[model samples]
Target: MSSRIPITLAGLAIVLSTASALYSAHALREQQQLVDHLNGQVARIQPYAFSRSDLDALLSRQSLAVAPPAAPEAPPAPMKRESAPIVGERRYGDATAQFSLIEYSDFECPYCKQYFAVPKAVVDSSRGNASVVFKHVPIHGEASRREAFAAECAAAQGGNDAFYRMAGAIFSSTAGNGTGTEKPLAVIASSIGLDGAALSRCIDNQEPLQKVKADFREAVELGIKETPTTIVRHNPSNRQVVLSGAKGPEDILRAMAKLVQGNGAAQ
Candidate 1:
């Protein structure tokens, strides 16, 4: 039975190794969670950290003067809320809130990925004052469109929370401006604890795709020519500021401050 003792000891050692590895992994994950939480708080405070001169220079670089609507007759996109659920069903903040910030972006666009941080900062700063809206302008063709569909499906299944989680996954996994592959996209759906089989069915249907397409059509109509476009408006006042291209945290907050101050964009 001496041989049996050695085999038993080997098996016990393997078990201990695996248990140690799992515990280490769990500890690392917890540490990561704490770090991410602290970082978010720090990032939220960063926007307000700039001085007036710094903000002015940033705004000047942004050409703080927004361009006039291309056509006075054709309504500018994202500017009007006559259309309810402006960002569709996936939204954050008090539904009855008076301020609105809209971001038009593509899943495959790296700049768009970076700007995703803007909404949280704005919404957090606004507190009960502002609402964030997400508009899909998936410009990288079918692959991007597929990713958009996946996000919508997640929303359909688990509402706005799940939608954001899936987006975080897409933006985090996708490299450069490169597209995320189908398998990774599927994995994202599953990671969010969404129904993967149903997501597949939904993507196959493509009927829900109309929501994103409509946003695209409206963007074209508004002459919103690029990804990472931001539209900030204060309700009742209805003042607006439309910013195109990727913006630094200072740039976006200052632009948004125009709406919050009820100044709107300079005419």
Candidate 2:
């Protein structure tokens, strides 16, 4: 009985060992299957994945695709004259003079006042070689326009000499910057030996307003922008030089000399 008991114990131990071995083998096979399935999933997703350098290159390409903003445009240039300005009846110096200094002036302009005597001085010095033509710009509003009309009215009553006298008196008497004279326009007219009542009548009737408007229109057509713009013209050759701003008599004479030299005509 003791021997049979020993044999039974040994057989039971062997059976237990065999069962533990089989269970371990089964667990190992299942674990191997799970590893294979995970490896298959990783293989399938590998083609769609991006590297760090590839992502950086794609971002760089996107950044380069956008365009930059445009730059602003520049301003246009000022206009130039195509033809010479007209020299009408309001002229000083010899009518048959070789050169005409077409002076486009404003009454209320201080610069115009400074340059008022310059054209006359040039004419006086030229000795019948150069003349001056007075044209109104009147850029200083109503006061200037009225004075322009007054000068034209003086011309209408007393001819070109009266016109020049009125212009000179207006320039001499005005406070400038459109303040005009302390005295009345009629009083100013009378002081210059013009009939005050007749001058007033002409201003009221607006007879000389057309002439002033014509002068202003001519100035604009000639592209005279500012006060004291003198166009030194050779009447024989129709050659001209533009003298802008408040030019001295010497400067005007120099420009005239150039024009004369350019023409090769005797002065």
Candidate 3:
């Protein structure tokens, strides 16, 4: 019985030793895998590391020795003309009024047709108090020159009311569509109730023709490159504000308000 016990104990000890050997082999494999993974991570990070020489090369390439650009100078203000109100009427109560709006318009410009209500509203609200002037800029075509002349001719016959109505009709017409022809200026003149014979006689008349030319020259002098540019002069003290493009009434009113504030006028 004693000899059997010794053999059993020795066999148990051998089995324990085999189990420990398997565990050690598995542990060694796991450690080796961890080491390899760490090595790969280090390799991946290597390229991102820039040396002192690399930084020096980058600095040399950029050559950080250039001077900064000069600060941009503000553009010169547009010179205001001390000329007469080219066309239309100048009313009283203009001083205490809220705004001064000047419309640079071409009779043939469709955009100008859109803003006919604006001037009417400004003038009506002013009630013979504020000043709203119309300066003709004949840019539509050859016909535009005659039409512009006809407007002044109508003014001569019937005053500003007739002239304003005729001007609006001409702008609203689709005659000047660049197809090499339009409703004759004589037709437009007759349609506006001006004497057709008188309009024909005065078609090429140089008087109204000169007025338009003078307006064009003034526009050029003022750097007005676009039609329907509304210039608002809210105050005598503040510089005049020029709104370019075919702006709506709200935009024009906002601009006028700014000028009025600047000039110490009531909102």
Candidate 4:
């Protein structure tokens, strides 16, 4: 019996050793395969890569400007109606253009900063064909809220140019900490050559503040919890296309084209 017990123990050890060796070999092969696959993908992407500007251009056309708020709640009033532009908000292009892109952005968001150039290009490309309606929904921190008020003040006093300038300056420069502190909205207004006193007065006043608050409420209602949420509206039929995210520009162009086609077909 003792002799048989020794034989059984030896056999068990050998089997265990063989299994462990096989398992180690399998794991090594899997690791190698994973590495090889990753390398191949990297190589594939390396050749077709783009510069930051080029990447941004590509990203801009894809139509992702903001993400919907994680916990979306209905706005106090109809989002489409309640946040209607008052006297002091920033607006660009014709009041009667066939289509309008409404952008709800936080000045502090890096993605919003990246998207800033896109609207400029789109506006320039439109050449009186389309218009962009701007709204301030400062969802970041205190500085963003301050800038929102400043933008409103600029729009109220200096009009679209002032507001545009302030927005452009703030978004164009990568100088802030997502708080209005690093690049104060007031300074941006000053850089654009707007009247300092008027900008200050606009910021200090409550009317513009109220308008901004209304828009923020509207944004909440629309489930906008992120930096940039864009609503593309076809003016003729009052159709709505809600695009949420910091998507690529190509996507935006495609969506716009598809929208135009669909609208044309419906007509």
Candidate 5:
């Protein structure tokens, strides 16, 4: 009887140990499943949490996945209207023409250089219908101012024709950006058949500086800021069209046509 009792107690102990081991294993598996479920929920909710760092990271990944955007196109140049009358002394073409192109230019501006011949081209193309007037804006400091004075001095020596000739010589010779020319102003004047010594005297005496300053002040009052600003005015009706920048001859012609058409004149 005693031996049977010992064996029974040993068997009971072994069975209890086996059941505890199985329970522990099952509990471990359930705990692992709960952890996995919690991790999955956190991942799903992370995007909506609005965390800046996480959002930035997501945006970066998206940007890398997509193609870059195309480059933007340049904007068109501006054209506008004004009521200012055409005012300048250096006139080219017929004085009695119906329309006048008043060119406010800088001798040392590259854009002014580009547009040097455009006004003359328009005048020529207009036949007897249009003219041009030159005004000095000399915004490129002393070099431009000196050139303006020299051209005016040519006018003083010769007349309107000499002024235009001097202007042409300067425009043709200058390297732009305040560099007047490789040749001296007087030399350029002589080359153009003006009295170079007299022109130099005129410049030294500052005879034409006031004319340049007046033009600049007039431009300021009219709100003209950029180089190569052209004012197309109809002498008959006092209608004005302002063109800013280095516009081609065609652009001026087109503006002229529009003005003529508006006035019920023949094309």
Candidate 6:
């Protein structure tokens, strides 16, 4: 090799080493500040367009807003009650309710867990005029898929009541945006009075996989890219309103009331 070749290679090595060191320093600095990490991530990909401060403010507001507990022994409400019937959906409230809230949720989605009860109270307060429909959108991974199927298996054993019970237990026990485990699934089933052996067999078979997949397919078709995407319908006029993230009860109710009032005025 030429005498100059060695010098060139050494120079290239020094440059690369310097660049790598700078990147490491930048990453470490970013990681050290939780606030910066969140803001940077959102600035990169999230369309929410909110700063980290904005999200923190929202969370603080939610924490201040007290939420009521679900009924201790209530069965899963009902499913697919609209004019267009869905064969296996798990639902709550009256089939003939004047208002409907269709929630596209994932078992492992913490946001869904956080916002689960807003519409429940709305439906309850509606005095048989509103209903809530639950759709399976297992976005996390295999564990999420398993939890979704376990819910369906609960339905198979005891119908929609079992399904909602299992779902409620799972959502209540969920820690964060993470996968679920078999022990919790079985425990929730057993607690809800489902046949343990039957649930295990059903989960093992994975037949409910296709059932969950169908709901996810529909969600994708509807441009629903997030969990807890709630589509509240003013049934009489067929108007729809969408809410994403952990929306509070007052916000949802106000939105629903506005839609109803606006539609009524129009008619």
Worst 10 residues of 3 by lDDT: 50-59
Tens-digit lDDT track of model 1 for 116-179: 8777666776546667788877666566777888888778777788888888777877763445
TM-score, per-candidate, Cα-based: 0.65, 0.65, 0.57, 0.62, 0.65, 0.64
* Candidate 2 structure lDDT: 0.71
How do the residues 115-175 of candidate 2 rate in per-residue lDDT, one tens digit apiece? 8887897677665777889988776666787788788878876778988999999998887
Best candidate, lDDT: 5
Residues 1-267, candidate 3: write the lDDT tens digits. 998999999999999999999999997786455445434433443231111111111111221122454665986565443222235442223546545576777666555666655655644544442356677666655555666777777676667767777776676665442221256656776787877566555544444655666666766678776666767775445456787666554554455445534533332
Clash-forming residue pairs, model 2: none
Q: How big is the positional error of residue 224 in model 1, measured in Å on the Cα after superposition?
A: 0.8
How accurate locally is residue 189 in candidate 2, as Cα lDDT from 0 to 100? 94
What are the per-model C-alpha RMSD values against the true structure?
20.4, 42.5, 32.3, 21.3, 34.8, 21.9
Candidate closer to the true structure by TM-score (higher is better), 2 or 3: 2
lDDT of 4 by residue, 1-267 (tens): 988999999999999999999999997786465445434433443231212221212222222123344664654542332222446446688878666777877776667776765655555555454577787766555566667777777666667877787777767754444545455455666778876665665554434666777677767667665556677776766666776655444434444554554442331
- lDDT-based ranking, best first? 5, 2, 6, 1, 4, 3
Candidate 2: count of backbone clashes, pairs at least 3 residues apart or interchain? 0
lDDT for 43 in candidate 2 is 43
Which stretches in model 4 have alpha-carbon errors above 4 Å?
1-89, 173-177, 181-184, 263-267
Can you tell me which runs of candidate 5 are displaced by over 4 Å?
1-88, 263-267
Q: Tens digits of per-residue lDDT for model 6 on 76-191?
A: 65533212211476888887876778988877777777667767876766557678889887766666777887888888877787787888888877774555753567777888
lDDT of each: 0.66, 0.71, 0.57, 0.61, 0.72, 0.68
- Candidate 2 vs 5: which has more lDDT: 5
Query: Which candidate do you rate higher for lDDT, 1 or 5?
Result: 5
Superposition error at 194 for model 4 (Å)? 1.3
